[model samples]
Target chain A: MSFFGPGHGACPGCGLTIATRNVLEALEGKCFVSNSTGCLEIVSSQYERSAWGVPYIHSLFENAAAVAAGIELALKALKRTDEGKVVVFAGDGATADIGIGPLSGMLDRNHDVIYICLDNEAYQNTGNQQSGLTPTGSNTTTMPAGELMPGKTGRKKDMISIAVGHGIPYVATATVAFYADLRRKVKKAAEIEGAKYIQIHTPCVTGWGIDGKQTLESARLAFETALYPIIEYENGELTKVRKIKDRKPVEEYLRIQRRFRHLFKHPKGQEIIRILQKIADDNAAKFNLDV
Target chain B: MKKVVRGFYSIAHSVKLCKPNVIAAYPITPQTEIVENLAKMYSNGELGDCEYVTAESEFGAASILVGASAAGARTFTATCSQGLVLMSEVLLNAAGMRLPIVIVNTNRALSAPLSIWNDHQDSMLLRDGGLIQIHVETNQEAHDMVPLAFKVAENPRVMLPFMVNMDGFKLTHAYEPVDLLDQEIVDSFLPPYEPPVYMTTKNPLTFGSYAPPHCYAEFRVTLQNAMMRALDEIEKAYKDWAEITGRYWGGHAVGEYTDDAELVVVSMGSLTGMVRDVVNEMRREGKKVGLLKLRTFRPFPVKEVRNALKNANKILVFERAVSFGYEGPVGIEVKSAIFGFTPEFYSFAVGLGGRDVPREEIVKIIGDVYEGKVEQGFHFGTIKEFEEVVV
Candidate 1:
């Protein structure tokens, strides 16, 4: 659907732009959206020019889920729930960092709304600052690779598990490369009657220091290495897992992005890469992603 | 119907009368009773057709109201102290989006000694947040102001959020006899909230968009103009509300008893009641002292204040919160409003951190200001005795 219109102020091949478009397309203009302050909000709805044809609101960074919850309840209060589904479009920073509390609140209240986290893994809107979702061994502006310390020291937060733990009706993870899978998940989540969450592995061309054309390729690599598993859950139960038909080593995924360039060159680089590989292996083992 | 009720219950009863479709709140002290009563009313089916959400945090409470308001519902919330500070970001967002959500802010001191005491610090922090801030002295006024606040805030000319501030614990826990309006009057006075901008499937529109520097300034100017226009809108609401309810606080941003006075005392919130009492005592004693109570702090009522205070030989200002290293927030605003007036000015910071502002001190402060004793800048009223410890 062209509801998520073109000519948005996003970087070329920005996976977030693609991801948001896919979500809106999946909804097919039958939803009211609440956007958090992030790359998507900044790029798509700047002033007089709006890329969204659907009803939308961009209110604060950390309260998209909370706002969407209100929208859902308000719709119910007005006896207008049949009007459209309510959805929150936010970033990893919004869903996993500062906004996590409000997101948790929304899920706990079980508002009939869908929350989508476009996980670019850093604060791309603020020029690549470190976020809770910035994976370990990855370099962000605030977590620069230095002589004293490596990249982001800790592993990325397990936001999926957090959402699932809330006992919400539906939770899923998708990527821009898996358009059909992403659209299918978004549509299914929107159709569900209770709180839902979808975390899409959105790759940032500018923030990730990758060529714009490699946006999909990078997102695909993230899944192929089992670093970001494309999985779905219903009512706290794992329902489906997108098996990796051809698994690649984490290095293939890391090598293309400059954020991990220091990991390949430093004396401790190889060890860090091995640890990252182990992480992917663990994810694969846990989610049964390997074919 | 008049009932003897705690201040928080009065707030709850008033909100119930307005029949807000959504009331989202996170439990915070002093303000908790208001939501507690609201939840009870919802459960008992006394407050009909309302969704009461017990949000996880103050942020959740405020954000829920913002979303609910944007989705075209008459939304309400109650919070104070840390809760108000926590809701600060959304407070700004609610105004910027012109959502017209009504929030009752039970004023309390901020933390770092972690005090839950009554103070003006919380509401004063959001003075410029593009909301119609109405600070009421009595529980009755707090109750009366809710529907009027909604009317003013939702006015097409002033599509801004509204905050009604009552002193936490001091007023929220105090008991008062309030003549509550019936649901019929409330419903008629405050029509179902219908916003021009909202998230509806039938008519799609984007709200809270990113404005470039050029567009951002215009939006801010619009908000400023809207806030300015709120003064008249608020008066109009008062007039309409008075016609139906047969109750009207004077139109000059609250009652001004300054017509036949040689000296005038200024204050806001619950402090005004005591200030009025002191003025009455002085009047009986043949002293020409009167009180100017500020009800609408935002849109500051500059002209009314100047008119009421211009004739006085001296003006004494008492405020409940300090801005730290400067005059009290209300005193500073009063100074800015009456800039050219030649009255002997004394700005006193009193009752901070919930310290009692004894009636004698108010009398003494007035006496000092009249006798040319008090200094011009920020004066610590009762805390002056414990200067070493306070400073």
Candidate 2:
């Protein structure tokens, strides 16, 4: 049985929706889900209509992990831990920025739950606002590239490392393009007993100003360019990596998305391009993502 | 048996007797002792089969309790001041989802100068959060109200959250002789929570979902109806507890001694204890004055308020919080309740931020009202030096 159904409020070619579908499909419909306030919550469960067939709760914007932890503890209190899986869904803004403290607390407490963050790099639901996960040299509503300042100043927050630092049993990164890998990671997290975190690189067509059909292509290029590396860690130990062979240059990924189009315009644009390439190079070196 | 204990221990002892399945809390000043005592009990095996969660923040604690309560477990939490403010969002979510969670809000002031002192502003901010707000007078009532709050909130007719407001530091730190009921009696009085519906895998259902305007208004109306129904449930719970323990106050919603009195002073929470003493002194000296204590603030008890104050020749409202530029929080509601009545109304903003309003100070304010020296609207008795300030 499918947990998440089709035909809801999700936008066309929404990468987060694709990743959510793949994750829930891997669960085989035996789970209780909690969602933080974001696009996924707004789109999936609007008024009388619900896209989720499984038991679900949508709480505030930054408390999904805590909510899921309570559910897990409640199930344990009722002696029904084996009956279902407890999972939490949140966006990058909720996970990396506003919700990081509670998310860290849940991991510190070692609750039996899975926290999946659909990282679209920026806040796409509230009209593409800037978030902590917004990458450098990308335009968001709050951090627009103008004559005065560049797109975003800093690199995206490294949430995988934060999860690993909590000494959780499992932490992984995946992209929507790698459906098999995403499914495998979700299933693996569900099987674990302690806190598990999986961050999925979800490409947003509207936020990035790309064609709806180009969502998958952009996700693939993200992986190839080492901008969104697929890495897995088990109990603070790096266990798996998706190495890139014939690694594509960061230019290929940047050219298609208009969020980064301004990086090719002004005299300062070339320098901003170099900064973006350095981020990719650093990730490639750190995760050994290049062949 | 009656024992002299800090007000915080009374709350902890009452919670122990209530036997909640889960308690998730973060410590804030004036509210920390209650959670600390519970944590000690959980560690010492005195609190049985309860999951005591020490959350990262007040927001996280409130969220945890909401989830636990929605999952069909009896849940509790305690917080004050900024902690309560931080949990404000989760409070609305819990109430909207109809989770019968019980919380003790040690009332404290919001900060610009950053003081962890007593005031009603914290709980006043949550007046419309759809939870039952009960203000307590004595430490015994603070103890007694815990089980009562749980019973009323978890009742099938209500099924809404409840908040018990006790003045921060003033009552929370005071030592008093509280006659806590026997464990057996408390157990029989407040039964285990059995929610009609919950979040579970067996019977899958969505909670806290997005509601369109059509569906949203109905939920709000339903919640309001539940609040109204809670008045009866609260009385029933109190009556049932009184029948077993022989400790009945006038009513669960309000208590008044306005009969045969010309002037009535209205107030709530621990501050009422001081007001009651002052009124008693004034009565023994042959003054025609009485006291009206508001026990319930959310369901408002508007009818009781109007009925209690209707016969008085003059009415005065003493409260610990202000509505910024307007009257005191409770004062405005009291005025609305008695709109058609013809008592010369006066409101005094007093005892804010844990400022001790001694019996002499209360007597002076009453004395001013008696001599017709006070104006028709609001007055600040203690802060007269800065009465010219906007608030």
Candidate 3:
């Protein structure tokens, strides 16, 4: 049976929907889902009509990981470990911003659950606000590109490194552009035991100001430009890396999205683009992303 | 079995008898010992089939209980003061989702000048948070209210969260002889929790769904109706426990010397004990004074409170917490409960921030009211001068 049903309120070509479907489809047996208050929860479970075909719950925004820990422990206490694996689906804002404390708590306790961060960069549910995962030089509602400031001035938070720093059993990064790899990472993480974190780069079509048809392309460009790395860690050691072939320039990824349009138009736009390229070069050098 | 133990220990023993599936909490002041004792019991293998998790914060603790309860498990946690304030958001979520979780709130003073002492400020702040709130007057009552709270909260008619409030330093730190209920008797009184709908693969149900303006009010109305239904459920649980244990701490609102009394003093929590003593002393001196102890604060026990105080000519409500711009929370509710029936009503905020509420103070307040020295509005009792410091 399909894990996620139809009639969700997700926008057309929504990368979040694509990534969520891929992750849920990868699960093997019975599963329970704990969702944070975001686009995924709002679109999927609207009152009496729910798009979830599995047992699901949505508590608050910042407590999804803690709630999942509780579900996992309750299952063990009830002697129902064979019932299902507990999973959490949260946004980048919920994972890297308001939810970091509870996320750290869940990891510290090493609860047997998988936490999936559907990273849409910004707070898309709240109308394109700047979140901890919002990349530098990207314009958002909270960090608009004005004459005084170009856009967000800081780099995107390395949430994968933060997860790895917890020394969890499994940590992986994926994007909606690579569906097969995304599913493989989820399936692999599900096989492991202790706390697991997987952050998926799901591009927001509305928030990114990209065409509905260009969602997958935007995610792919993010990976091809080495701006978003596809890497995995096992036992706190870097285990695998998806090598980039025929690397694309950072401008190819920046020029298409309106959030980054200011980066090309401003007088110091090229300077900022050069800085973004230097960031990608640093990521490539750090993760050895070259094929 | 009768044993002299700390109030927190008695509560832990009572919770052990209840057999909760999940217990998650963080340590905070007077509320720490209860969870510490429970953790010790878990280590000793006395708590069976329980997952005891030490949460990072009170917010995480309350959220953990929310998920555990939603997953068809009986769950519990404890917090007070700032911890309660931190858990306020999740507490509302638990109530809104109709999770039958029980929490012990060792009522303490809220921080401004920062004092960790006994007061009703903590639980009073969440008065409208939709949890079924009960205030205990003694250690024994605190011990008994655990299973009683779970019984009412898990009742299918009233699937709401329950908070058992006991004065922080007054009841939590004091040692008292409590007749602990036997495991078999507790088992008979509170059956294993059977949730009507929970997260299960076979059922595949959705919980905590997004509600639009068209139906949000309806969900709130449903919760409010369940709270109203809890009034009867609380009474039934008390009767059932009393049948098995032969100890009843009065249903909702308890009365002492209230019949044909000229003056009635209304209060809650451990402060009622001191007020009861003052009432007894006044009675011996030929003064017709009585005491009305409010047991349940959320539903307010409006009918019972009105019935107990209607015969009295003058009603004095004393509370440890104030509503700041308004008056005491319980006093506000009590006034509204008996608005037309009472002609002389006086509300007093006393013993705030764990200041001593001696019997003399209670007697003095009563004297002032009877002698026409106190007005018909809210008053602050037992105000003392602080040492002047040149900063």
Among these predictions, the greatest TM-score belongs to: 3
Query: Per-prediction RMSD in angstroms?
Result: 1.8, 1.9, 1.5
lDDT by residue (B1-391, candidate 3, tens digit) is 9999999998999999999999997999989999999999999999999999999899999988888898999998989999999999999999999999899999999999898998899998898989999999888899889999989999999999999999998999998999887899889988999999999888898899999999999999999999999988899889888888899778999888889888889989898888888888888998888899899998778899889988988889997999999988888898889878945989899888899888888889988886679889898987767897999
> What order do candidates take by DockQ, descending?
1, 3, 2
Per-residue C-alpha lDDT of model 1 across residues A1-291, encoded as one tens digit per residue: 368877588988899888888888888888999999988898889877888889899889899998899988888888898888998999998889889999998998898998999999999999999999999888888989988667887889999999999999999999999999999998899778899999999999888999999999999999999999999999889999999988999999999998998998877788888888999999999999999
lDDT of each: 0.88, 0.88, 0.91
- lDDT-sorted candidate list, best first: 3, 2, 1
State the TM-score, rounded to 2 decimals, of chain A in model 2.
Answer: 0.98
Per-residue CA lDDT of model 2 for B150-240, tens digit only, reads: 9899998999889999988888999999997778988888888888998877877888889987788999999999999988878888788
TM-score of 1: 0.97
TM-scores, one per candidate: 0.97, 0.97, 0.98
Tens-digit lDDT track for model 1 on B1-391?
A: 8998999999998899888989997898979999999999999998676788999899889999988898899999999889999999999988998888899999999987888888898898888888778888899999999999888888899999999999998889998898977889998898887787778878888888888887889988999999989888888888898899998877645435688778888988888888888888878888888888888888889998988887888788888888877778887888888898887777888887888878898889887876678776678877544445654
Residue pairs that clash (backbone atoms under 3 angstroms), model 2: none
Residue A171 error for model 2, in Å? 1.1
Model 3 TM-score, all chains together = 0.98
TM-score of chain B of 1: 0.96
Off by over 4 Å in 3: B386-391
What is candidate 2's TM-score against the reference?
A: 0.97
DockQ-based class of model 3: high
What are the per-model DockQ values? 0.88, 0.76, 0.86
The whole-model C-alpha lDDT of candidate 1 against the native structure comes to 0.88
